[model samples]
Target chain A: MRQIKLKERPDGMPSAKTFQYENVDVPSRNRDEVLLKTLYLSVDPYMRGRMSTGPSYAAPFKVGEPLNGGIVAQVMESETEELKEGDIVTGALPWQEYIVADPNQLRRPEVHGAPVSSALGVLGMPGLTAYFGMYHIGEPKEGETVVVSAAAGAVGSIAGQLAKKRGARVVGIVGSQSKGDYIVNKLGFDEAVNYKEENVSEALKTKCPDGIDVYFENVGGEISDAVWPLLNTFARVPLCGAIAAYNLSAGESDIGLRVQMPFIKSRVKMQGFIVGDFSEHFREAYEVLSPLVKNGELHFEETIHEGFDKVPDAFLGLFSGENVGKQLVKVVEPEQ
Target chain B: MRQIKLKERPDGMPSAKTFQYENVDVPSRNRDEVLLKTLYLSVDPYMRGRMSTGPSYAAPFKVGEPLNGGIVAQVMESETEELKEGDIVTGALPWQEYIVADPNQLRRPEVHGAPVSSALGVLGMPGLTAYFGMYHIGEPKEGETVVVSAAAGAVGSIAGQLAKKRGARVVGIVGSQSKGDYIVNKLGFDEAVNYKEENVSEALKTKCPDGIDVYFENVGGEISDAVWPLLNTFARVPLCGAIAAYNLSAGESDIGLRVQMPFIKSRVKMQGFIVGDFSEHFREAYEVLSPLVKNGELHFEETIHEGFDKVPDAFLGLFSGENVGKQLVKVVEPEQ
Candidate 1:
């Protein structure tokens, strides 16, 4: 089986030279283990953070080890009673086409008649991250305007929808004009700012006339500067991810502290959270989100790349805003 | 009577040129008011924010208008039964030798057997600010290492003592060696870092070996850069003031955005708050803090600028780090 491994850490934006594709031996499954055959794997922007050696919520990807990510797989063989042959599961699986995994660590995702890839996108970690970050941290109230950056990405798309359901006027900041239209028309955002073409601050002032009450900060460059000064008093900012600055070298720094005055003046409460921060509430999140996603009350989009070797390219594409929504690599077709 | 007026808006550091001293006739009191003679007028770092025409927690002081701030005054003539002659009160009184104010708008501070000037320092706004910001926002737990910047100042001094009282190890960052010595030797801080002498981040790494669990962010700029990276996962930061950035022109921007990565990687919760945000809880803060001051469990310092005419000088001195603890202009002699 072919697997992707880290060849060298990139200084700035990562390139194809940073990854190595190699054939690996398939490991044998022991007691309480299941041999998983990779089907669909998730490609997220946050994975870029794991490539560097720094203080991160998730451990860094080691130089000679196969890259690990969210993967939906079918159980080829089971040595434990918890999972059996042909059972489907998802978790932090390796990039290889096949591997042995503990049944305890794998999740039995509820597909609910949708594509099995939904197990890695909407009903999985990204969806759950949006649920807790928006509800617990942002706490969007009726008539409040909510602004989210990278609105076309996995977490931001789901977060914008959840904020709308809570009676907030959602405004999204996207990298391209089409993605802006996608979020505003297809995903129900009240307004969308094309960060590429428009004067972001001026656009926010015109769109968010009531002032931004809840800012779901996903991208953290010039987009953040445009959002902060417009925040109303007692505004809440849930710091989800900063795909904009994730690729900057370790020694590089930006002008983020300029917002401290605005933060204090507005009495802002900003928190940076990981999905693992709410680990105990995972089931609670699933119970609420799974139904909305299945019934179409909540909407999601996925951009899929075919074949196993497209994983690294799919991930790198996230930085340039090439993907429309939840970017995933389709490895195999599930059996009927 | 003498009053201080804002002559002009400052570009960087405020100076005597920005303030105009003028003589004004003491105005008559209303039916529900009391004529007040200033005893001790407070000069705080937060006033720096009010001098500029920008978004701030408090309204900006208009050019050619009298400046206003906290003052301990004695009732000279009472037009209401609620206040009588000789009754001492404190509130947001104008920066003048005398004024007329409503009894309801003033605070009849509970002295708890300490000097009446304590009403302007530990028994008043700065004390209450530290109390709520540390307890409610920072949430310093026992055995945790707490760090407070601008340690020898009024708010930071009390905040450090409060953290020590909570059984946490405290590290202080101060401007000079004397202020550094004052906090560690006199105020019981576990360690002190001189931002002027040593490298701040390296100093924090050496002193806060366990990593900072709670950071009372009183000063922004490079000092903030030092404290943020050293924060532990799920750490709390209470944003009090930004004296360092207060002097920077409204148009100037700093490299504050660099902290976002560290903030997210550590799962940090940083909130900016004014003491007035918790107005209903003032009595609760007083009930806990007053006894600590009377019993000498908590110690405080004051830099007294000698006369009512010295008010503007005292206010101006704050940006240069003139005060050791609370900077107060002694407006008049106490009752003999």
Candidate 2:
């Protein structure tokens, strides 16, 4: 079994040097454990937060231990009656090609005859994060303008789509023209502003004719600077992520006190949240998001990298804005 | 009758040149308007936002118009059946010596036989602001540490007291040592950090032994910088005022984007609100706060700038941190 390890923590924009590749013998299943062979691995922006030693929603990665995140694997051997051999399960697990997981910790997500890779992207943590942030936090009213930063990425795309489902005029902020087209045309967003192409502030003013009422803030930085002044009175901002600050030098500001005045002046309610904080509502999120995803009412995309060795590249590409949607690695093919 | 008019839109802070005092003939009361003799007028941090041009909860003051705010006035003549002559009423009224007021626009606050000026201080806008922000927004639980900025000022003092009433260990951040002493010694706050004298962040780390669960943010500058990182998981911030940012040059960032990472990592909730936004529940706020004032359960202080002409100076002194409590201009004494 092959796994990835954190060799060194990067100061900014993690590179290949931060990771170490290792090989280990596939372990046998224990009484409560299910021996699994990895089928797909998910690399996420939040993993960057786990790299540094600081206060965070999740614990930081131990330097010599195997780095782990969302994984979809097929059960190779099972001692528990809950899961059987050939059954596929998904959850936060180690980055190894094969590993043992407790049956209770993994979920057998119903893919509704869809591809198993969907479990790591559209039907997994990314999907749940978007769903909870949109419905429970953003709470967009019909016909109100809803803006989402990181609009081409996993959570942002789904959040914007769900906002549209709730009858909001959804405008997306993306890094490239192609991604803008993908969100606007393919994902059914009302508008998409290419942040690299045009001045986002002026573009937002034009697109969101009615000032933004709910801002699903994922990539906070200049995008936030543009959205701040345009927020309508009593706007609600579900602060989900700040990918822009993940690579900043220590002591540097991300979306800092700049928001304080705007928040005060407009009576804005900005709530920061992690998906785990809303774990009690995960079943509800799946019930709501699964149907739309299955019925093609909610569109999702993914940028796939082949092989387990490509995991570090997938994570590094996130900072450089390489992926259009959920970035995942195809570790190995699942048996039909 | 004399009134204060906004002379010009200020570039940063309003000076004597931005204000014009006008003398007008005292007019007879209209059938629906009661003739009012202003007794006390409030000068608040929020009024500074009204001085500039931008998107604010309250409309910006139009140049050449009378500057108005929460006022305690004596009815000189009854034009409607709603009010009688000599009745002390409170409302948002012009900063004028004598003016006409609509019965519907004024409130007859219950002061429990306390001074009428209490309507503009402890029992009026500032009091209600602190009351609602603390209860509805901060929602500090018993034994949790609650920190308030601008702690000796009108809103902060009342907020800290209410937090204490809720059984939270209350800590205050004040701009001066004397104000710090006033809050800790007289008001019975658990601790007070003099921001101007000591390292605020370190002071907060020491004073708030359990970390902060609720932060009543009124100043929003260095005080916020100190308060942000100390916020515990799921900490609630009732963003009531930004007095520190009231006089910054246009486009200058005050309390800018430095809070983003801390806010996100801690899953904090920072909600901004004007007192008037809770106007529907004003009666409830008064109901809850009035008895406390009457029973001496809620201690309050006021810095009285005597005479109607002192209203401008009183308003300006707020930016300089000159007041210990609610700053009010005593325009005239109530009728005997």
Candidate 3:
């Protein structure tokens, strides 16, 4: 079996050298345990926070330890009646080719005619994150305008689509023209602002002539500065992530225009949240998202890299806007 | 009669030169109107926002126009049945000794054995500001910790008392030792941090051994920076005012540590609001607050400057932290 471990904590932006590949023997399963072969692994931008020693929602990943994340696996041999051999399950597991896990630690995702890998994207954490943030915090009303940053990424793509479902005038902010087009044309966003090519503030003013009522903040810093002034009275901002500040070097301050004055003037409600904050109601989110996926009312995209060796590169590509939507690594093929 | 007009918009901080006091004729009342004698007027931090041309909750004060704010007045003569001569009322009125207004613009405050001036402080807009911000937004749970900045000011004083009423351990951050003693010894706060004398962050950590669950933010800047790291999971911040950044000169940015990362990690909900946001439910707030004030369960203080000419100086004193509790100007005594 092959695995990847954190070689050393990166000072800022992580490189390929940050991860060390290792070879290990597959361990035998005990009673109530299942021997599993990894199929797909998720590489999310939030994992960057876990890689460093910092104050974050999740505990920091220990150096020299095997890196772990959301993984979809197939049960090769099961000792418990709860999960049988050949059953597909998803769990937070080590980033390795073959591993053993208790059946209780994994869940069988409802495919609903979609690929099993969809569990790592639309039917999983990213989808649930979008569901809670947009539906609960953003609360985009009908006829209101919504602007989403990083609109082509995993969470933002789904978040924008959810806003569209709520009958909001959805405008997406993306890094590239292609991502902008994907969100607007394929994902049905009302407008798209390519931050790379256009002045985000001016472009947003022209696109969102009514002024933004809800801002779905993902990539903070300059993008956030552009959105703040355009916010309408009583605007809601769901602060999901600040990937732009994730790689700031030690002692580097992520300073920008202060939000206090503008926020008070606009009576803005800005709330920072993670998907797990609404864990108790995840079933409600899944009920809402799963139906949209099955009926094709909601659209999603995935940028999958072949082989387990590509995990580090796939994760690194998130910073450079290389992926269109969910970034994943395919470890092995699930047997029919 | 006398009135004060905004002579010119101040470049940064306003001085005596910014106000132009003029002798004017007392306007006569028309049909459905009442002749008002100004008894008391409020000088609030938010009025500073209206002094200059900028994006704010209220429109900027015109250079040649009289500034208006919450004022308690006596009805010298009434042309309608709704009010009569010698009746006391309060309204948002211009900075003048005597004025004419329609009866609909004023509301009779229920004094409940308290002074009529209470209408402009603990029983009026400032009280309502604290009520909605602390009660609805902060929602301090019993046994939880609540921290209030500008703790001796009108809104903060009331807000801290409200949290104490809810059974939460309350801590107040004030600018001076006297103000700190006032919040702790007089207002029943569990602890007080004098930011001018001690390190605010360190003092807060020692006082609030339990992390802060609710923060009533009345001052923004370094005071806010100190509270951010001490926030507990699911902390709620009701941002009522940001006086620290109110006087930033044109083209000067009010920059500070970005709140996105810490907020997300702690799942903080920071909401900016004004009393007007809860206008529909003012009766509900009054019903709850009036009883507390009447029963003497809620204590209040006032720093009343005598004479209408002292209004500008009283307003300026707020920035310098010269006055404790609600700062007001006594324009005249009621003719009993």
Calculate DockQ per candidate and list them: 0.07, 0.06, 0.07
Report the poorest 10 consecutive residues by lDDT, candidate 2 chain A.
A327-336
Q: Candidate 3 local accuracy as lDDT? A: 0.68
* Model 1 residue-pair collision total: 5
**A267, model 3: CA deviation in Å?**
19
Instruction: List TM-scores for all candidates, in order.
Output: 0.76, 0.76, 0.77
Which regions in candidate 2 have their CA more than 4 angstroms from the true location? Answer: A251-336, B255-336
Give me candidate 2's TM-score against the actual structure: 0.76
Off by over 4 Å in 1: A257-336, B30-32, B257-336
- Candidate 1 lDDT over residue span B1-336, tens digit each: 777788898787776677777887988777787888876655666566677876655679999988887777788888688887888888887767778998878977665554455555555556566666676577789999999987776667777877887889999988778767777777788999988899999999999999888888766678887766667755677766655566766567645633333233333453544333455654453444334334543223334566433433553343233343334444333221
Task: List model 2 lDDT by residue over A1-336, tens digit each.
Answer: 567788887777676667777777877766888888776665666677778887665689999888887767788888788998888788888877778988888987544444455455545556556666676667889999999987777677777877887799999988778777877877788999988889998999999888888888776677777876676655677767766666775766644534443333344453433333444554453454334334543222335565434433543443233443234444333211
**Clashing residue pairs in candidate 3 (N, C-alpha, C atoms within 3 angstroms):** none
Residue B316 CA displacement from its true place in model 2, Å:
53
lDDT measured at residue A37 in model 1 versus the true structure, 0 to 100: 79
Worst 10 residues of 2 chain B by lDDT: B327-336
Residue A44 displacement in candidate 1 (angstroms): 1.7
- Residue B21 miss distance in model 1 (angstroms): 1.7
The superposed Cα distance between candidate 1 and the true structure at residue B54, in angstroms, equals: 2.5
